[model samples]
Target: MALLSDGHFHSGETIAQQVGLSRTAVAGHISQLSDWGLDVFKVKGKGYRLERGFSLLNAESIKKHLGNTKRAMIDVESVLPSTNTEMKKRIANARHELADGDAIFAEIQTAGRGRHGRTWLAPIGGSLTFSMYWSFPDGYQSMAGLSLMVGLAVCEALKDFGVDDAELKWPNDIYLQGKKLAGILIEVEGQIGATAHSVIGIGLNVCVPDSQYDVGQPHSDLTSYLGHTPDRNSLAAAIIKSLWTLLPKFTQQGFGPFAPHWEALDLYADKRIVLQMGEKRFSGIDRGVDASGALLVETQDGITRFHGGEVSLRGNR
Candidate 1:
């Protein structure tokens, strides 16, 4: 994977010798790269190459660059169906054994996830994908606006990498230059005695060069906006650090401390928008979010509050 990341062809014999494998074995592996969400090109004379360049995430590099991350452990995988699922399985089996801030980062997500049972897919190394496991002493109800807070974390992370104008689309999306840049998915599990656990998953577009990759919405990547790819490891560390600093504040003050900040970054504030709740649709002007994290929209009838729904610009379809 590392050798092919340069987007240039390398003869099969050269690849085999570099990895200490036979050319036949290398050929077999090349045939299956597509299964991992990578597109490899083969030519009559040119051995093999990726359609574009990408860098693999390194867990050690992310951890080493982090500040005050001694409490939790970080692990990176080459590919995963979903990082949130992996963390949830662990929390269910041994909540007592898991520590707060434990996280898992994936280099390639074959079946990446989104809210409302939607799929968030990206090309291999074209996005930053990871999930953090946070355990709280309070019940699930204590955290009303957790998703919005998670978006703030990603927004701050992007700002650290020199992309300063990121905004939060209501509920759980990060937008840059008026296009979707990243998203958040938070799955919370409340146990007896008011103890709770949350698997906070974040998917960020880094260098998506293909127009065929559809996320059902217009989206952009960091590379296109920044003119150069920010080191994935460095950005991962920044996000992890941002989450570490914000989680405890939200736990202590609920959503009060973050509400004003979220309102400032609200992407559709005071703009005409459509709220889609299954088949029911409500057209309204965005009134921003209330203290409890519910969206407030001024429809023709009146100001309606919604706890969960898909939000987009009016007439976007």
Candidate 2:
């Protein structure tokens, strides 16, 4: 796959020789890659070539872009069912063996997930899919507004990449041109007032082909808005750096310092919005998020505060 990522043809014989495999075995691997959503062309004389070229995530490249930050230990994998799931397993099965800022990046996720039990499916090399493990000594109680903080981190990272129009969708999404460009899922485990371990998973559309971009929602990709996003490793490094910097600062300061930024980037701020919690629905104007990261809304009754998990509204708005 690495040899063929240049979008140039590499013959079966040459690929087999390079990877020390038989020509037949090379064909089997290429078939698997295609099944994973990578478009590969097999011409009789030209051999195998990708429909588009993209860099597979490389830990060294990500780390180099990290610029001497000793905070993270990164791993790059070819495929996974879910990076968040994998990170949780690390915390669950080997809690003592892992450190803060341990991260996993997958090129493709066959069963990726999103909020509200939705499947987060993305083609190989078409998105940024990864999870990072962060520990908070202040415990689960300390993670208030954490998801919003992470969303801000991604927005700032994209801003550094010359994408200044990205905005924050309250709770956990980044919006570009009022369409979903990226989403975040945060999972945590710990008791109150004690240390907490969390896996922060983020999936951002980088260069998703139009054919694979239909998830029944108005969506756009970074490449479309910014002309082109940075390479996967470079973008990953940017996001990870931003998150790493915010993690400790958040622990010390809480969400107060970040509330202003979240408000400034609020995509739905002052917009008529609808919130649905099961069959019950509430209509209100988005007043942006509060200090604790709970979304504040001006309902007919009065000003109200609602937290995550109850405000799924891509359908209601």
Candidate 3:
């Protein structure tokens, strides 16, 4: 594991001879690591090495946090350009081979991104950005509000880590008081019919400092907010476990299943908020997400449900 994390390439024969095993055994180990979420490059005659060197997120520690769930389902990567990007590649590759239940996690995304072409500002050794890829059901159109559920998972993880004051902004941003703490980006892959893969990407400012971003939006991290960084391994495991427990239910009940919980975490719920939908804009009290995951706003005329697409929500006060 140390050699693998060192970012150096190792040939199956070299590793096998070192460990007193056959080249086949070394190759098997590489396969197992790939199955666990580490991206390994195999050059027929050259050998195997990590796509990049990264601080390994201990699988055993993550599994301990997972409790009883099958460990084989997740793929954890220590360093990735972007979890969402990696998952897209995985989905394309999986097209040739039939498999399901795959996820990609990264300690930090070198090029993490957010909704509407916004760059996800994450610094190495400071934050967590990971993505999960899942094949949802056909009628999963009912799960439109799934991002809200994943937001709840993040909040629950924060609560478990003693950051209970964390709050949820509409759609996907998590906040503390008024500062941004985390964000979520959900992207879908596949055609209108057949199997559709949903990639859920998350960015948590775990320890990012104020200097990381320019003057505009304020950002905070668990480490700075709490005076020390929370254990990344524990947090990653908690997130995976939460997603595993909630995703299946999300498939069955749609976003409605998690609406109430989402409401409880909303920092702007029932409060005045502004909806920045392109050139048009509206300000109203947020009634939280309706049954379909649309933002429900109680305007003077009545209630308006805004489906999340090409829009941004900001707390008025």
TM for every model, in the order presented, reads: 0.91, 0.94, 0.78
Model 1: residues with Cα > 4 Å off, grouped in runs: 18-21, 44-46, 210-212, 309-317
The digit string of per-residue lDDT tens for model 3 on 1-317 reads 55666678787888887888788888787786665446789877777877656455666777787777755445667567788998888778855442344566765465678989788876544567788776776744855887888888888877788888888887888898679988899888887766678888888877666864452588778878788767777888888777877888887778886888888888887889898888999999999888778899999988999988889988785
* Model 3 ranges off by over 4 Å: 1-56, 95-101, 211-216
The digit string of per-residue lDDT tens for model 1 on 1-317 reads 88999899999989999999999999888876877768889887889999887777888788888956566888898868899988888887865477888899887677788977789886678788899988778777777889998898888877888988899888988888888888889888777677888899998989875476777888989989999988999999999899998988988888877888999999888888886776787887888888779888897799999886455344334
Per-candidate local distance difference test: 0.84, 0.86, 0.76
Q: For model 3, what is the error of residue 234's alpha carbon versus the real structure, in angstroms, after optimal superposition?
A: 0.9
Q: Model 1 TM-score? A: 0.91
Alpha-carbon RMSD to native, per candidate:
2.3, 1.8, 8.3
Clashes of 3: 2
Q: Report clashes for each candidate as comma-separated counts.
A: 0, 0, 2
lDDT of 2 by residue, 1-317 (tens): 89988889999999999999999999999999988878899899889999988878899999999998765679998888999998888888854477777889998798899997789977787799999888888788788999999999999888778898888887898988888999999999777777999899999999875566587787888888877746888999999988888888998988989999899998887888888887888888888878899988898789999988756754243
Q: Kindly report which residue pairs in candidate 2 clash with one another.
A: none
Candidate 1 CA-lDDT value: 0.84
The candidate, 1 or 3, that scores higher on TM-score is 1
Best prediction by lDDT: 2
